[model samples]
Target: MKRVLLHSAFWLVYLLQDTVLEFVWVGPALKNIPEDVQFWMAFKAAIAAVLPKLLFTYFILYVVIKEIIKGNVRLSWIILQVMAAFIIIIILHRIVFVYYINPVIYGGVLKERPLFHVLSVLLAVMDIGFVSGVAITMKLLRIQLVAREREKNLIKEKLGAELKFLRHQTNPHFLFNTLNNIYALARKQSEHTAEVVMRLSKLLRFILYESKSNLITIEDELRILDDYIALEKIRYDRLTIHFQREIDESSGKIAPLLLLPLVENAFKHGASESRFDSFIRIHVQLQQGRLTFNIENTKENHTAEEIRDNIGLGNVRRQLELMYKEYDLQLQNEPHLFSVRLYINLTSYAQV
Candidate 1:
């Protein structure tokens, strides 16, 4: 129904334009006639002239343009077809004007011209070409709009696939480390083993369900972080861990499971490998739609190559690049302490 209205509007405008042009060209000769009668004559002439123009325009748009876009017809054949159709339409238009319109409008007073007159054919070309050009331009614009929409959808799908692959890579690496901790507790026959298993179950449920979304509330993310920190504390009895959060506003969203890999990297490289007492310090602060996460852990002497080769840190870096445009991930490595600071503008995430 919308398409029908659009086509009707196009032809209506064409008819009005033709009526105005007819008045401008021959209005002085018809000055002796009543104004109402002159307008009626011009409108009648436009109606009579519209039939051939309409047919030729739609034929070129729907038939010739369709075949050209499909690339199914030869160029020479298409050119021959268009030339034949143009000649036939011009002849038909002349027949309509000479036989029907002139007799009614001029009372058969005008001299009869040959059907294939050069002047009549040239007038038909101008009239038909104007309407056809407008229709073809509209058709091409619609095609371009549809092509652009399809391209955007394709790019969105590709990005979604890549994010899923990166998330999958991180999930298994995280579960492996947690499961190893559980194994250690089970082998020692420690009483905290059951509690640790329960915490692991909660973490698994969150990973399986909540982490599927692109974003999650900061409060939910914090809860998961607390749970993971508790599980890690059970595994390392002598390690000093400080997890502090100062949130002025918790009403913000972040990528789910985005911070867990960083925490896991701290324990994997800093606390687990150290022979003496080690400490992990974590600070999370959110204010005015900006979040700052800083984690530092004491470590024994290690080469820069060893720290750079960590899978968890690499995963975190890649996810940050993929997810946020306004974010900074800084790594500070010293002889005895390694630190990571992440600053993100959540306002930008909201815009995205």
Candidate 2:
């Protein structure tokens, strides 16, 4: 639709330009001819200008300049064509000037002023060439701008696909770890084993149905996080988990399964490893089209091999980068503490 409007507008503006030229010639060329005929004469003179422009416009733009840019036309060849164009334009300009501009404006013969005539004719031809050059330059700029926009869109889509794949892979790895937790409880014949397995099944169903999607609402994700936290509580009675959502439930959406990895990493490395100081603190909220999620966990140390080798957190980071160009995710370590802060600008990237 935009292209159509631009195409129509270009021709409409060109026609207006030609009509202005006709108005300029009409006053001088009245010649006692009938009023209607005088108007036609002026219009014809304008056509003489526009028609000459058309002759070289496409030839220079499509054939000469395009081929040269594509490396299919050589420099020497372009030089020769330019020289030929000058000769042709000079002849064409003389014909139009002698037959149209001079006769209409001055009622004079062609050879009456040789030097003045040649200079005027050359100037007219060069003027047309100059207009055509400007037109081509604008066209080249538009083409380059469009190409660059397309390249940027392509990169964004590629990253989005990678993010989707990464998130999908996370589902199974998480399931594996949770199943191990359930298995340990079952081996002990603990009374909460059945309840834990039921909670795991519910979490699995949510991951299977919701995480497969391109986007999940903050409300739904928070519910999933709450359920997972319950399962963690069942796994370890001593674990202390603090979860808070400071925003409205229906605030915004995000790429699926994005927040889970951050929480999971905290619990696995921080709460699971530190028996004495085992706790996870989480806070989330939406502000000005952005979601800020902050999590801090008590950490004994950072040297756990599982914590260092984890790719699940890396996957979430990559997904955040792809889905939200305007986002901040920082994981920092302090004495007995592991902290994560993620800020996502949902307005920057289109929802899937």
* Winner by lDDT: 1
For model 2, name the residue pairs that clash: none
Model 1 spans with C-alpha error above 4 angstroms: 106-119, 306-311, 350-352
Residues 31-73 of candidate 2 have per-residue lDDT tens digits of 5666666556556666666666666766776778777778977
Q: Give the TM-score of candidate 1.
A: 0.90
Q: What Cα-based lDDT does every candidate model obtain?
A: 0.86, 0.74
Provide the lDDT at 5 for model 2. 95
lDDT of 1 by residue, 290-320 (tens): 8999999988976553447377778777777
Q: Looking at candidate 1, what is the lDDT of residue 172?
A: 93
Scored against the true structure, residue 257 in model 2 reaches a CA lDDT of: 83
Backbone steric clashes in candidate 1, count: 0
Candidate 2 structure lDDT: 0.74
> Candidate 2, TM-score vs. the true structure?
0.78
In model 1, what lDDT does residue 308 have? 71
